[model samples]
Target: MADLAHGKPGAGAALSGGHGAASRRDFLTIAGNAIAAVGAACVAWPFIDSMNPSADVLAAGAPVDIDLSHVQPGQQIVVLWRSRPIFIVNRTPDLLKTLQDTKDISLLSDPDSDVLQQPGYAKNWNRSIQPQYLVLVGICTHLGCIPSFMPQANSVSPGWLGGYFCPCHGSRYDLSGRVYSGVPAPYNLPVPPYRFVSKTVIRIGENPPDGGDFSLDSIEQI
Candidate 1:
């Protein structure tokens, strides 16, 4: 449908380096994202370039191969696909528990993923093929502002068990990208079709072997 959040990471995201060894990087140019003014405290970013098919990312919507060996647990990286930002988070074990916490479920608008915001394969509590890793089309469904990756408990506010927060309108999503109740974003963040090429490498824009041909448009919203 329409272009997704085409800008820098959302404002005020409290970031933490997964391995703390990643080299510092400058602002990356995403498909449709602008060099957003991410404020001061959110400046340290370490990114890597992935190998894409011969087809240009904007032209053929080619599959992108990301080497996640360097992504330490509790860290995340961003890539571009079809001009949209793809957020890949290497979830930590403790963060995984928050997704299943009853209290976490109680705060979600669709903890069951019943809204079709993700493909059938991802229609579950964890919302990904693997619970340890998460892939989301990093755009807020409300107004297309990229949600800041707030990965610490209560990072945004009290009892906030680490998730993406859209400062634009206060919409909050869990680690699994499930939308929270009473939020402006009616739908959860869209889960892109992806499959693990290896234990540490993921190919975005492609589905799991058994996922059939899942279309990005099939989701209810971005």
Candidate 2:
């Protein structure tokens, strides 16, 4: 994997104290539209002849299906894949604009994604195959702790912008899961290999039909 072109100088220096972690009810309420499920029931295994996949296969990490139909713009939901938290967010038009802005990109540690933090298909500005949907591993890069989904702008700190915040270490990431320049995390959140099975369903753990030579294991981190 390629290293970050811009070396981190003041990493972890911008830690602030203001907001506490979001309550579970608040998270569910925010993601009310984003109903999701995990395991092989969500996948379509072309190679498998059996109608039912064995429990072992699912336990070993079979692709899961995510329903995007209910997810409204600007909302997000979390799903588990291979025992790792997967963040699926529906980005609004205005939110997408923020990601493309030069001013916002300049604040990221690996704005251009020179490093192999995600699949080639997800190396774009939105870090996803589809611009409206963002899929990322929820674990913080600094530590094994999970980051809270503080989507509202400045919810954690002043000028926070909307994104995930790691209360454990104060690491901040953009809505696209890109780590901030001055955070304790060294790399961006990892995007798992996945593709849209339909307009409303996404199959995680499988590469996109149009995407070539991409794999989750090839990422810099999980």
Candidate 3:
């Protein structure tokens, strides 16, 4: 009877050992699946980040488009390209007359436009494809402060003529954005590289190869 009891106890021990081995194998399989899922998420993160816009967009020198349909006459709008502000102005008939009337020629530092200031197509008296549209950089050439637009008629203070006024140093520009002879700024505000993609759309920052440099010199010659 004692020999029979020892044999039954040994059989029970063998069954428990088999069950433990199966449980350990199942645990390892679940752990491996969790690790694989984590690895997949890590790989996907970089692709998601690449889809976002970066500083490279500014460095690439891409052109920006402005819609003129809503741009009111005598008002100006500002847009950014390559970290620079490009100002677009819709001139009233009076503003156009002011540009035409300022004919001293000698008063303008680059009156003949010898310097490369704007694109070729923008060299006209108004500095744009349409007489009412005017595009220029907002930063003052003297010290890089943004000039304030004083568009109201006779807004020019005291002896100053009507135009943009730089509060930093009291520099004055005419309605056509030509700097006064005695101002701190040596040159007129630069006209950025731009083109008219449509009647209502102006593209800034890049000039078309077929269109040429569009610099101030080119426009003056036209």
Q: TM-scores for all candidates?
A: 0.72, 0.72, 0.65
lDDT of 1 by residue, 55-160 (tens): 5644558788999888889998989888899999999989999999997798889889888777778888788988888999999999999999999988999998
Segments of candidate 3 deviating more than 4 angstroms:
1-60, 102-106, 158-161, 214-222
TM-score of 2: 0.72
lDDT comparison, 1 vs 3, better candidate: 1
Tens-digit lDDT track of model 3 for 30-64? 68888999999999999998887676874665777
The window of 10 residues in a row where model 1 has the poorest summed lDDT is 23-32
Model 2 clashes, total count? 0
Would you list the C-alpha lDDT of every candidate in the order shown? 0.82, 0.82, 0.71
Count clashes in each candidate, considering only residues at least 3 apart in sequence or on different chains.
2, 0, 8
Checking candidate 3 for backbone clashes, the offending pairs are 118-214, 118-215, 118-216, 119-214, 119-215, 120-214, 120-215, 123-219
lDDT of 2 by residue, 1-222 (tens): 112322466433122221577545446644653544323434544446565646886677988999999998988889989888999999998888778778778899998788887888888889999899999989998987899988787798887778888989999888898999888999998888899999889999888878776776677776
